[model samples]
Target: MNDWRSHFGFHTTPFTRELAVAQRFPLPMFDEVLTALSRAVDQRGSAALVAPAGTGKTALLRALVDQLPEARYRVHYVKVTDLSKRDLCREIAVACGAQPAGSFPMLVRRLQEHFLSTLADDGVRPVLVLDDSHGLRPEVLGIFQILTNFEMDSRLVLSVLFVGQPPLRDLLRQPAHEAVTRRLVHLATLRLLSRPESHRYLAHRCTIAGATTIPFDPGAQEAVYEIACGNLRATDQLAAKALEVAHDAGAAIVDSAHLATSRRLLWP
Candidate 1:
């Protein structure tokens, strides 16, 4: 077979990792998450997104970025690390387009100046989105307070969005982290879809890929749900692989057999 997408009459690769914002499925949970996080950033408030792996944390982060207007908000995505406080400042400085060189205190001043300048000069609120933040050390996570100290915390010049897995929630709940935790205005979460939502999600993905009709039969859909348990990334991987398996076997539509083959090929 040439390619599964072609065999299935798809104009583009379905269940792909890269998708335009407009092409994203209208999952109610995703919409709710975006709305809550967007509201937090718009109000110059901080937030945390805690979800398990493959629940679409990165996708939702990208969507939230698109949701915020560039003219109003300058979003900086910082890759989290277990670095020292000064090194972490360097990382954040680099993300904020500030010169990433200085002692810890100097770097903090410089970053504060940069943020104040952006707000004063361009009328833009700078947002720091830290992904994989569950990996950040307690000392490093404490840096949020230093980052947000604007005019004795009276001025709201920056917003920090913490994106991580469930452990992040527990990490933030520590008594030592109470100051930073208090700053978070919202905590958004993404969940595995229900069975019916999984079916609709697959259909919506097919539509987004320019398919005239969904190719997964009922049996195949159920199999994917049972195996993937409605995690968005898992569903995408299983369904895409199942389509390939079906195409290789010259099947007209994906069925439970194809899904079973996909399970073996993917898991075993």
Candidate 2:
């Protein structure tokens, strides 16, 4: 147990990365993005979720998986950072419970068959979440043509979601990657929070972590916002460390000075 968690009278650690889906911060923008992506998958369409690091893309995906009904949607999430076409095929095969051994062409064919069978036999749609896709080379992204195509482009049997950083938005716009870009029916991204939102978010994280009262005073909240610039993950890190600094000094509430010191410890 961290000394700060005990000092603050929290039942659990505040501002942590490990949060339950039910306990997720109730941000309206998160719900909006999830609904749009859910609607696209419902219609058997592809989509992209582009967000900068620490803006909560991964947490959003967790909520997305929960939103998709297990009985109706065969959702498989595979993180695709720097993976080759064959490596990606193997990862998807494993996610779908298929043997992950074959030539690249054979793997593709096998995956298509598995997706089709899942839909035809079980009345479930297959949704592939290709996460961290900004690392994919343009040529590697071309694999989407085969995955999304079936029966000479007459059947739509698979729905894919590309979740990645901002570069992914530009990568999809390149002419060489038009095939995959054209297949996307919805695009979404998370924005950095405004100053007011940052304060509310800090309080929410505190409450959810079982705090009776938020320890960060108004000035400390503003200090964190100034340094983290309203990024969710950044706020988490800054607030958590500031609490430690305050605890070390035997301070009951965190203040701007503690936040300033925490920033230097973190970044410098």
Best by TM-score: 2
Clashing pairs in 2: none
Model 1 weakest 10-residue run by lDDT: 1-10
Q: lDDT per prediction?
A: 0.91, 0.92
TM-scores for candidates 1 onward, in order: 0.96, 0.97
lDDT of 2 at 238: 94
**Which parts of model 1 are misplaced by more than 4 Å?**
none
Model 1 global lDDT (CA atoms, 0 to 1): 0.91
lDDT tens digits, residue span 1-268, model 2: 5578978879898888898899988889999999999999998999999999999998999999998899999899888867788988998899889889989999999999999999999999999998898888777888998989999999999999999999999999999888889999999999999998998899889999888899999999999999999999989999999998999999999999999999999997
Cα lDDT tens digits, model 1, 76-106, are 9987978899998999999989999989999
